[model samples]
Target: MKIVVVSDTHIPKRAQRLPSRLLHELRSADQIIHAGDWQSLEVYEQLKQYAPVNGVFGNTDNEDIIRVFPDKKIVNVNGFKIGIIHGHGKKMTTVKRAFTAFNQPIDCIVFGHSHIPYLKYKNKTLMFNPGSATDKRKAPFYSFGILTMSDELHAQHIFFKSK
Candidate 1:
């Protein structure tokens, strides 16, 4: 499976549209997973054009988005369980918060907020933050994530200087 992961696309608040690089990657996606902070449902609609879309709602999302998604969720793709969350909280690091969001076993965790691309293993679970496709913040470039699965699940970040 080819999973295109993205988050913190603050939409018109950040970039006027999804980055071309991200859209390009989406073309080959078997599925798309969005972590959160999507400012508009139009973004969701656009993504669905490429593949099946699944996501968790973020702190910045309004009721409209929240109504369509959950604050946190777990999805099973190709027999691997993946936890999804938008890492925004009053205390603790975003990574720590995401790690604790799920009580059951999962193969990976996908989160956004703080807009920093990260790919690391926590015990057996791979934690991934695709960063901000639209808002890179202090980061050098805009970024997103891709996960490919066959015998095992592998994840990596796709970074670009322009969004």
Candidate 2:
């Protein structure tokens, strides 16, 4: 399966729409995952046009988004267990917090909040943050991610200049 991962789109608050490059990836994806900070249900609706969207609600999301999605979720793809969270709160780093959000072992953890792209392994779990598709924050370029899963899991970050 091919999964396109994105986060912190911020929609009309950060950009009027998703970057063309990101949209292209979405169009070809088998599934889509948004970590959080979508800012509007419209963003989810737009993404749904491309593929099935699995997401969490971030701190900036409204009640409507919260009602539709939860703060954390776990999904199984091909034989891998993936945990998804927005990763926003006080104290601990987002990565550390994501590691503890789930009770059981997971093959990968997908999270977003700081708008900085991250992909790393801790203990045996893969931690992935696709950064901000629209709001790159301090990052030099806008980014998103792609995950290919079959017998093994592979992931890569795709970056491009913000328009």
Candidate 3:
């Protein structure tokens, strides 16, 4: 399965629309996952038009978004257990908090809150943060991610200059 991963869109607050490059990926993805901070349901609605979307709600999300998405979730894709969370909390680093969110074993943890793209493995679990598609914050470039799963899992970050 081909999955397009993104987070912290903050639409209308960050950018008016998703970058064309990301839209193209979403159009071709078998599934789409947003880590959080969508800001509005319109973002979700827009993404759903292209592919199935699995995601959580971030701190900035209102009741409308929180009503549809949880603060954390686990999804099974092609025999791989993936944990999805919007890593926002009062204490501890986002990555540290993500590791503690799930009690069960998970092959990968996908999170977003800091708007910093990250990919690493710790304690044998893959940690992926797609950063922000519409909001780069202080980052040099806007970015997103893609995950391809078959016999194995492959994840990559795609960076660009535009929102």
**What is residue 93's positional error in candidate 3, in angstroms?**
0.5
Q: Give per-residue CA lDDT, model 2, range 1-163, as digits (tens).
A: 9999999999889899889999888878999999989999999999999999999999999999999999999999999999999999998999999888999999999999989899999889999999887988788999999999989999899999964
Best by lDDT: 3
- Candidate 3, residues 1-163, lDDT tens digits: the string is 9999999999989899989989988878999999999998999999999999999999999999999999999999999999999999989999999888999999999999999999999798999999988888899999999999999998999999986
Cα lDDT for residue 55, model 3?
98
What C-alpha lDDT values do all the predictions have? 0.93, 0.93, 0.94
What value does the lDDT take at residue 113 in candidate 3?
96
User: Per-candidate RMSD vs. true structure?
Assistant: 0.7, 0.7, 0.6
Query: Which has the better lDDT: candidate 2, or candidate 3?
Result: 3
Q: In candidate 1, where is summed lDDT lowest over 10 consecutive residues?
A: 10-19
Runs in model 2 lying further than 4 Å from the true structure: none
CA lDDT of 69 in candidate 1? Answer: 94
Off by over 4 Å in 1: none
Superposition TM-score, candidate 2 onto the true structure: 0.98
Full-model lDDT, candidate 3? 0.94
What tens-digit string does per-residue lDDT give for candidate 1 at 1-163? 9999999999878888998999999999999999999988888999999999999889888888998999999999889999999989978999999998899998999999879999999988899999988898899999999999988999999999998
